[model samples]
Target: MTQDELKRLVGQAAADYVKQHVPEGSVIGVGTGSTANCFIDAIAADRARYRGAVSSSEASTERLRGHGIEVFDLNQIDSLPVYVDGADEINALGHMVKGGGGALTREKIVASVAMTFVCVVDASKRVPVLGLFPLPVEVIPMAQASVARALTAMGGTPQARVRADGSPYVTDNGCTILDVRGLQILDPVAFETSVNQIPGVVTVGLFAQRGADLCLMGTTAGVEMTDYRN
Candidate 1:
């Protein structure tokens, strides 16, 4: 199957899994990115199964709403049982590199509150280690270059994210992203902690600390379920 076909399969699998597992009226946490968009489209079929969703990005929010799924504010909701999203790269340990959509901070926040985090991805996304994909670091606008310098000292190539128009790409939180490349993250948890300590860094894209509870990886055969929580 093609990449988009694989993503659609995994997205449907995620929706099926949640509809069968999550409570009838529970609220959910949704994530960002293209794969996550597939999940959003999939979940629309069972929109009434859950109350609504707390979205990680405005793009996801709009997509969710377009699907007729009610999008709720995180502050208004106390508990999120399931957070379903996609990863840029994931390993056997379930560590992931996300935020390609510039929604890292909110994704972290929503995922933090969820009881379970499910990552949906195509098979190509699986990797031996994190960091093959450029790790995105959301930083305050004024500190963008400074944080890039700090990332450089850490032995990574940092580039400020820009739009198609060559303007700076501002995140939903009004921050800019630095896409750092070339550092092989052998220890994702430690690296996450260390990068978060940078003054201008709002949040790193590493999802190690609250990694996937499970992953629905779409291969040519089918959607293969991997349970990390086990």
Candidate 2:
């Protein structure tokens, strides 16, 4: 099957998993990117079953609203039973390199509140170790250079993310993204915490601190569900 087909299969699996597990009237935390978009489309059929969604990115929020699903502000929601998103890379330990779309800050925030985080991705995204994909780090615009230097000192090459127009890409939070490459991350939690301590850094792409509780990996055979907590 094509990669897109595989992504769609896992997206549907994630939707089905949410429907079967999350209780009725619960607010879901939705994430960004193409795979998450596929999941949003799949879940549209079951929209009425849940209260609404707390979206991690403006793009996902717009998509959810387009489907006539109400999106509640995260600040207002007391409980978020489930959060679904895609990963750029995921290790066996469930740590992820996310924010390829530059939504790390909000994704982390939404995931923090969710009781269950369900990561949906195609099998190609599964990696023995994270960091092959350049890890995204959001930073304050003025501190971009400073943060880049700090990231470089950490043994990675940090490049400022730019748009197709050759202009700096700005995130939803009015920050910039530094795509850091190099370095095989063997220790996820420690690396995550260390990067987060940089003065200008908003948030690193690492999701290890509160990694995926479950992962739905799509392959030609079928979707393989792994509960990381086990």
Candidate 3:
């Protein structure tokens, strides 16, 4: 199957997982990205089953609204029961390299708030290590250079992420993304904390020790579940 088809299969698996796990009257956390879009589509088809959702990005909020899923700000909700998202890369331990769509900060916030985080992706995204995909770090434009230099010192090649319009890609929170390459990360928690210590660093794409509760990996063999819960 093509990548799109694979993504759809994985997304469907994730949606099914969420539908089975998230109880009625529970507040859900929705993330951004194409795979997450597939989950939203699935959820929308079963609108009456969910209570509401807190979206991680404006784009996701719009889509949720189109599907009749009530969207709320994070502060508006007392607590989130489950947060389902897609990862750019996820390791066996459930650590992920996110923010390919530049919504990492918000996505992380929502995921952190949820009781459980479910990551959905194609099999290609599963890896033994997390840094193969360029790590996305959101930063303030004023400290972009400083942060880039710091990441470089940490053994990464940092590049300012730009838009197809040639402008600096601005995140929903008005931050810039620095795609960092060339680093083989082993200790994700330490790396996350260290990167966040940099001035103007909003949030790095590294989803440290906060492992996913479950992962839905789609492959030619079909959808498979990685249940971290024991």
For lDDT, the strongest prediction is 2
Residue-by-residue lDDT tens digits, candidate 2, 1-230: 99999989999999999999999988999999999999999999999998999999999999999999999999899979999999999999899999999899999999999999999999999999888999999999999999999989999999999999999999999999999999799999999999999999999999999999999999999999999988
lDDT of 1 by residue, 90-178 (tens): 99999999988889999999999999999999999999988899999999999988899999999999999999999999998898999
| TM-score ranking, best first | 2, 1, 3
Clashes of each: 0, 0, 0
User: Evaluated with TM-score, which candidate comes out highest?
Assistant: 2
Q: Give me the runs in candidate 3 sitting further than 4 Å from their true place.
A: none
What's model 3's TM-score?
Answer: 0.97
TM-score for every candidate vs. truth? 0.98, 0.99, 0.97
| Candidate 3 Cα lDDT to native | 0.89
For 58-121, candidate 3 gives per-residue lDDT tens digits of: 9999999999999988998888988999999988788899999889999989988899898989
Q: What is the lDDT of residue 115 in candidate 2?
A: 96
Which stretches of candidate 2 lie above 4 Å from their native place?
Answer: none
Query: Model 1: how far is 190 from its true place, Å?
Result: 0.6
